[model samples]
Target: MEPRQTKLIIFTAKLIAFLCFAYLTLAFFPQYAHHLLLVIALALVVIGAGSLLKYKSQRNWIESEAKLLSSEEQEEEIAVSQYSKLKYYYPVIEYAYSANGISYTGHTLSHEKENLWVPEVNHWGDPTPATDRWWLWFEPGDHIPVYINPQDHSEAVLVKDMTKARRSHHLALLTGGILIGLIWLTLVVLNYTLPLR
Candidate 1:
């Protein structure tokens, strides 16, 4: 599926989940809302923490000197329907670097674009590999900064600024988790003190 389609599906699913939870708490199971909310809040907090920790681990890879060996634009076609087709564009890049006297070849730019998708549309508002935004970043035989694992030289990433977006995403998750937890706690307190009975 296209990236936009996948994002839409995920957003729709989250909205539906929130609506169902709200209905249950407000109308059908008011007495159990506190407990349910607590569970949901805890789940979000745990997921957020896990994401933050994973991002931190990735951030530990030290910067290294690497040179782009080759860069190629690749395309794949997907049949959206009998009458329409979608074309996705991506850059295939190979780079070489040395760490600890061992030379390593890496093809990974970043995990963010591993599954990036671009639909065949004239006006795409979202970030898509089809645009020059990504291709313009690097060229064949260009020297690029890379991050490599000190212990394992073979593991490396070619995209230097990829961590900025990743950090923001994890920070958002942590913030969302804290907000949800606080909201749930407030609801629990109000349930006990307001004397709705």
Candidate 2:
């Protein structure tokens, strides 16, 4: 199957599974459903804030050039649940760079954790050789622009996480809206479930 089709299938399966789980949870635990929604809202807010902070930190990294030593495509199997697993492909890049006369070997394409596995956060697409062939853009010994941590020369990335930079703010706002909506729903549920004085 085509990479895009496969990604769509996987995403659909995940969405269906999540919806089923949410339905079952709310059905079986009506009293605790609000608590579950609150937890999910808080988790989204925390994740969005964390991604924003990482993006801000990456903005301060100094730009440098690194010699590509080697690059390889690797696959990782992520288990979404006990019954299901999804396979994701990513590039393992090895490069050498020097900062402040100290040489370092780095092995990260981008600093964002999601960048390593998910190509797009909004769509939750799978990283495949056909979809994310970033390694194919360079050959051995090629000099590539990299961002290096000034204080820690060992920390480096071949690309600035533009996804994080572009999406973090939107994610924060989205999560905030979800949180407020969930809070309002929780209040309504409580009011309906509680006895009037």
Candidate 3:
């Protein structure tokens, strides 16, 4: 999987999660609280959109000027990611395997419903194994090995993890999550604090 695809998967998940959250709020909240929740949801949608626009503009500027920028500056970004120990990767390994004391045995598979990564060796459309392991499946191919940062095991991901526009995608999704959480909390607070109830 490429960075671009990983970002798409992550962003899609964020969008779906927010929509579900909104639906749940609308179904349960009273009129006043529902109003607040709706406003918050809209705000998140707008803010996330605005961020995309800004990112695209900057990307365009970079693309047009990328030729002029020093090669060092142009390539410095990925080399300076959150993980530094990933100096070398063993691309020969396949099959997503995790040795979190229990040695999770599973292949990386996409969760169509959740739109995110799952540790289950099973494909989507199944339940009871709603458990989470650490491997992120990218593309369709069993046991695709991915290099991990030994320092922080949680930061490990398969080759498909970098998705195109990684920074922008992560920023937008994180903002969306924060916004949804804020909206959810606000609705709960208003529901309990307001005297109208």
Candidate 4:
């Protein structure tokens, strides 16, 4: 499948999961709304903290022009318990960049953990041609954007869509946190307005 299609499917799945979670929490657990809201708010805050840490880590990485030295697809077998083996493809990339007249090599792509694996089989357990792997966006000799550590010039990474993803993650966490806060407030209002048993 194309990258756009895969992204759409992932987004749809996440939306469905969030909706189901919200529905289940609000429907059968109305009596525990306050506790649930508190838990959700804490979870969102933790996620936001994680994003903030990532952002801070990369904040000092200086952007520079780099040349793609090589790109290769390597396969690895992971044991999912003892009965099943999952094959995953990793795109190995090597790039070279120069900073302050010092030449350095790097292999990291980004800080975000990207889901680059696609099941080789369809939902029915039949073989499929789709091998979900990182599509190499830069070819050998291609000039691409790279982020290098100013302190350690050798440490570098190819610039993926990190900034955009970080922003979205932060926004999602903020929105979820605010929603939970409102839910808690509503519960409090109702508790005070309703007569005590």
lDDT per model, in order?
0.69, 0.71, 0.41, 0.70
> Order the candidates by lDDT, highest first — what do you get?
2, 4, 1, 3
Is candidate 2 or 3 superior in TM-score? Answer: 2
Predicted candidate 4 versus true structure: per-residue lDDT over 1-197, tens digit per residue: 96546977998998788778778866887565456566678778787767667657877788899988998876657676789887656577888889999888887876543423444565577775643343445479988889887788888776434555467767789778878877777767787532223
Instruction: Report residue 57 deviation for candidate 4 (angstroms).
Output: 7.6
lDDT tens readout by residue for model 3, 37-65: 44665666666565555334332221100
Model 2 lDDT at residue 157: 83
Error of 2 at 188 (Å): 8.0
Question: For residues 1-197, what per-residue lDDT tens digits would candidate 1 score against the true structure?
Answer: 97647987998998799878878786876666556656666767786677666445667889978888888776767777899777767677899999888888998876555234344454454544435446546776788889987667788876534344555666677777788778777866676542234
RMSD of each: 7.5, 8.6, 18.3, 10.6
Better of 1 and 3 by lDDT: 1
Off by over 4 Å in 1: 1-36, 46-60, 73-90, 114-134, 137-141, 160-169, 189-197
RMSD (CA, Å), candidate 2 to true, equals 8.6
Q: How close to the true structure is residue 10 of candidate 3, measured as C-alpha lDDT?
A: 100
Predicted candidate 2 versus true structure: per-residue lDDT over 82-173, tens digit per residue:
99677656677899999889889998787553466543222355443454556657689999899998778888887666674458555766
lDDT at 16 for candidate 4? 87
Tell me the RMSD of model 4 versus the true structure.
Answer: 10.6
